[model samples]
Target: MNLAIALTAARYGAATANYTEVQRLLKGPDTGRVCGVRCRDVLTGKEFDVRAKCVINATGPFTDSVRKMDDQEVPNICQPSAGVHIVMPGYYSPDNMGLLDPATSDGRVIFFLPWEKMTIAGTTDSPTDVTSHPIPTEEDINFILSEVRNYLGPDVEVRRGDVLAAWSGIRPLVTNPDSKDTQSLSRNHVVTISDSGLVTIAGGKWTTYRAMARDTIDAAVREHNLQAGSCRTMGLQLEGAQDWSPTLYIRLVQDYGLESEVAQHLASTYGDKAFEVAKIAQVTGKRWPIVGKRLVSEFPYIEAEVVYGVREYARTAVDVISRRTRLAFLNVQAADEALPRIVDIMGKELSWCEQKKKEELETAKTFLYYEMGYKVKTDQLTDRSEISLVPSDIERYKKRFRMFDKDKKGFITILDVQRVLQSVSVQMDENTLHEILNEVDLNKNGQVELNEFLQLMSAIQKGRVSGSRLAVLMKRAEENLRRQAIPVDRSGGGL
Candidate 1:
């Protein structure tokens, strides 16, 4: 996405500049028009103002905030919808192509797409009240899992263990007076001319961005009536869009013309500027990728393009990924893998330091997690103690205790203990009974109880327990065991 933006910016001959954030608006006489915008460079603490006859607000989801700059209330016009995706092993599905299920358990469509070697499926739509960072909750995960199981089979279970990555994206929908549901709102865009004459454009999809931009510029041109050059964007090819096929070079007249070569190059990169890229490629001994090469030069070519983007277009890594490249919709792994390299290349070309690079990486990751609804797992150790019980071991003990305490009682009787030990292939011998009685059977009423059984289990599991703690816990387990006690062989018996 950065490459595409840089290439386009270079073609337009626009110089890209960074802004810290809008500090204030420079208003015109009578405060009727926004004559300029003032911002400070977050790093340098330098302030600058951009004077313009007309201003366009392409701030997206934050459109309302920008509107407030003009002292106008636009109401809450942005509605954020969250979508999630789950990654599983390659063999989970065949046919490499993606699958789209219209009927999910939660009433949202499920996309089971082929992403590289792995299969990616997901998406649950939930309303988000907060405009800030949004995250996918446990409920969202369960919702997706239930849908997957329904379509596949009961045997196909998506446990917390199987998840490799999860993510969410916010689709900014226009709020309408007739409908309260965000999903029901139209995907089309709106260009609003505020009373203050601040033009704001909002709500469009990735594929229609060019059309959106063109329309926005046209609206600004008409409103401001400012002197400007013709709208050359229609026929103007972007930077990398040109090229000529090798076969066409064979003809003598065609060779002299060299028209086809230029046409092919433009078709490849600039779409209109194929001849320009071809001319540069020819002189510099650099070749753009043909249809099949998948081109190694493309990366460096893109690096050059990033130079163009940073210099000509107002682009950040976030804008490059979300708007320019449309990579946010691609698989999470591909996006994650490409992000660091992109940041490194951008930083070097843009003269950003390690701190700047770190900031960009963090910002991009946050955008992915909050704005996009993707789950990002960190390597931080929550359970740092090496002496803690193993999760598997804990689970096993829990299962055993639950099985012995039948009738939902909390205690285990002697009979219950004997039956359980027998199932484990252990003999219920006199020595074993004596040991069990000595260790458990608190209150000394000659009856084993749930509290006593639980105390024994806890001591064994921990390898040690305080005598006082045991006495208190055993009392409860004993009562529970008594209520759940079942008849079993009283005489010492073998399993």
Candidate 2:
């Protein structure tokens, strides 16, 4: 939605300064009327001034911070509530269907919806400290999972291992500073003008963004007594909505020889501009497989989108993964694995040096693990694996291990692992099979014993096993089967 707004605004002659921050507001020498803002480019540390007839502060959660620039004594208007969401396997919800529980166990609203080929179960609303990047706490995760289970049948199990990614966002709920209960605060937008002639907007959500903007612009025009025409954005079509159809992907598949999944994804995401992305893929795919190839086998997101995202003002790996694409939100591990290729492609396009590329990867990893809650393997993996295995889990592992141990030698060979993976419909090559053996073979015997298999399953179940071929294979197999049951192609991340 943000991209659509930016694209539409650009086409209509709106100039956007990306990665720029406002230093201070400029005023007239005599009348003290607000004139412009002193701005600094965050990327280069260069400062500049933007002269404008009207200045509107619509920084959402940071509304108070920007308002403070106008007057330090201004009271706060933003009461931010942290809302956390988690993405589970697609089978958790039916395709194109969503469930909304009006009241959770604690009287808050929770929803389970299908999103980007995965199930999105969210949102715990509680007063939180204001921060740019909010982390999803374990307690919130468990609360969501537990609450969601109340709506599902006994046969349908919700496991922590099925969670692909989790994220937290601050809801910019506006209220008087005296209001202590965040839940009771209305989501309606509030528009106000300071004595300094600075217009500010706070609260609201994605569903009412258009109305919020209309109200904001109307207030700005009214407050400044500026000459402007009536708003025509109500009937305005977004940048790519014109001349787009559901069957537009057929043209891409026919002309570019792209896969059905890839075609559908591009068509839905880029709308009429999908052809431009497809052309890049067709032209550059021969030179680099990563350009047209899928980032993960289970999803249809190709590498060309990274190149296209860069062209659309994406400056970092996080922008491409988290914002430009939904890879980071849908699947953190896949996003992490695809990071190097994204940086490599972005480096070539943006003229980044080797050091810049390294810094980008490191910064992106810090975000994925610290901000997004992606787990990394450490020395505690053994202890976590042991703790995750209970009597029932051990028994279940024993029964499954016996099926592969047909010879009853109390151990399974690499071929047995390959067979087990194949039984789950995971295609494995010889190299991957050896890598799996190396991870599970604790004694370096080139074979996995019953105890080793138990420990491996425990770690896999607990999602503590990282950088292991077996863990990735098992996860892929489970997720692929779940997605195959659904009909829609959600790899594009957004509609």
Candidate 3:
């Protein structure tokens, strides 16, 4: 219904039908009641007038602002509450299902919705000023982190780095005049008509939006004395509902080497429209394996998705990441890395200038960094990986690591270290390298920190002892590990 409504509004736009407006409702001359509405388009600075028999103020948190046009004295019964949602990678939850966290530390109900190959959790309610974009605070994030860890196993820790995107929305809830707690407020839709015949609708969830909209349209028709018939949405068939099945997915994996997870993501998100994405992929020869080995975890997204989002749904890099593909919500660094290419693609698609492209990239960065609580883009901070090293230890290792980590990304792949080590008189097998990394990498995130590098170097130095070397090394390493107060499991550590 939301998609249909948005498309319908686009079809009915006043301009060239190509431009969409974020409109502002203005107060016009009134005869003790609203006679007409003056609107200004926020995008193109265009102004227009709509003299309607009735007007519907369906704006969610801004409903009270709209009601002010009719009469500011109308008691603002709609209280806006901020709710935060955190998005992690798809591995956190089942691809086909979601989890309901019945309670949080704050006694708020949380939901883990597996949306578009990302796990969206939280919905902590806190009273906030009606701002343009409400942001989740550090307390909010830590609270969610603690709650998520409570449900996870002992070895699995949902750290701040795991969060890809975080967003907060203002829930327009109907409040009691004397109630102190807005969280206890009713979520039911509230509709009202002022003496000016302006109809205002507010406070409802998505499940009941159809009913809310039906009642709203009905109210508009009755108040305006229109000839429109009763709502036929009861029998409405949603778009892209044709011939969707698991067979299609199986065929995709069989024919295209797509991951079952990727297939599932597309099928659920686009329904029959999965064909369109696949068609693009096939034509461009850009098909990717569902578990993108390149990405470590299967990134069930393809280059073709960039094409689809531009032509079909998105206007900017932010839209592509946040809404169209859900990549930013799945991986923060990946999204940041992809942003420039996405902007370039979108710029060409939309015929954007250099300034517009820069603006789009900045917009995406702002949302990703601040709203989603992803990585701090400008600041160098610790706690990105599961491993920890004090500043002095980090600096010590970083200097030594720069010799091995050619790229200076603080991650030394086998090839990278081999390139440096071969320059010297050092050679090692892949298994040996893996064994060393596995031994020192405490968190098992496939990245070796400075401490790990020191440990590996020390192990290599201790290997010079001849006959008892194997037995002596093991015993000494174990004793050293005990002295250092470190624990080692199979492959050192497992996530």
Candidate 4:
């Protein structure tokens, strides 16, 4: 959806500076006229001034902040409300189904729906101070879980441990000076032209974005009597909308040697441009299996997407993981496990040095920990030190790999792999074990090395293992473990 918005802006010849911040508004000699803006690039720390016939202040929840820049005495028109959402395992909702509660116990709306193969339940509308990144509170998480359980069947349960990731967003609910709560405030968008000729648009939802933009642009045109054509976006196709189909993944599979899961992911994500991404994988220096390897073994996200995202203006690892792909949103653990490899690929693609790579990884981890509510163990480093990316599963896999390494070598044989599975109480059949060994033992050797074991196990920990019988058994086993009723961790950070 964000990509479509960006593409639509580009379609109209809009030159955007994504990370640029407005330091102040440029004013004309005459009072009550904004002529331009002085902006600073957040990423490069470069400052520049842009002169314009008219300036528009559409900063959403920060509308008042920008308005204050024009005139400090202006009253606040925006009442920002924070709405929190949490992602869980898919079983909470039916396949391709959604549940909406128009009025919850608190008389607020909440939705439990399937998104990106995971169940997303949200949201609680409450007054909040405006901020760029709002962390989801424990009370908000509990409220959602409790409300969702009220709507679910008796057989279905909403467990806190099932939450994969959670986030909070500020709703720019606009209104007068009266102290009405956000829920009581109407979400009707308002376009106001200040005395300084600054146009501010606020108080709209996703479904009303187009109307808000159209109205804002119409106001801009009328305010300056700017010559313009009528809006043509009503029939315009967004970027990647052309030449796309549900079956496009088939071509990727046939032409690029991509796994069906990976192909489908690419086709769904990039639309017609899936072919372009696949072409990169086809010609890259990496070998066949490695080139097409999944970032997280259980998920269909592949390394190629990282390079593709970087080229598409994904300046950070968090951008690639959270926005470009839904990995970080779907499963924080899986996203954490895949971080190093993603950073490595992105570093090479963006030409980042070792220090820059370290910075990127740390920044990504900080986002995951604070913004996404994933906890990290900050402690002393051992031979197996725990970084933000090294979740318990990785450490567990290392221990298991070492335990099964009969000769104390860095590698383990197929038999040892079977023993490790058995130790986990996962009873995979002989055929499935051999298939797993065949997939990860890239050299076609009869043994599975420690690194190969970690990759295989990490993939198995979360979701499906395509083209392998282990998918069903592993899924069932994981579900059973999940049903054991682990105590909920209510402190900051996640379960």
Top candidate when judged by TM-score against the true structure = 2
lDDT of 3 at 21: 32
Error of 2 at 373 (Å): 2.2
Candidates ranked, most accurate by TM-score first: 2, 4, 3, 1
Alpha-carbon deviation at 53 in model 2, angstroms: 1.4
Kindly report which residue stretches of model 1 are placed more than 4 angstroms away from their true locations once superposed.
43-45, 93-96, 129-133, 153-155, 176-184, 228-239, 244-495
Q: lDDT, candidate 1, residue 130?
A: 41
Which wins on lDDT, candidate 2 or candidate 3? 2
Name the 10 consecutive residues with the lowest summed lDDT in model 2: 486-495
Q: What Cα-based lDDT does every candidate model obtain?
A: 0.56, 0.78, 0.65, 0.77
Q: Count the clashes in each prediction.
A: 42, 0, 4, 1
Candidate 2 C-alpha lDDT tens digits along 203-317: 9999998898899888888888889865667978897789799999888878877788888888888899988888787343453332357776777888788889898899999
- Report RMSD (Å) for each prediction in the order shown: 15.1, 12.0, 8.4, 11.7
Residue 156 alpha-carbon offset, candidate 4, angstroms = 5.2
Model 3 misses residue 461 by how many Å? 15
- Model 1 per-residue lDDT tens digits across residues 384-438: 1112235564455457767876655344566776775556433435543545456
Model 4 per-residue lDDT tens digits across residues 115-144: 877889999999999888799987898899
TM-score for each of the candidates: 0.54, 0.77, 0.71, 0.74
TM-score-wise, the better of 1 and 3 is: 3
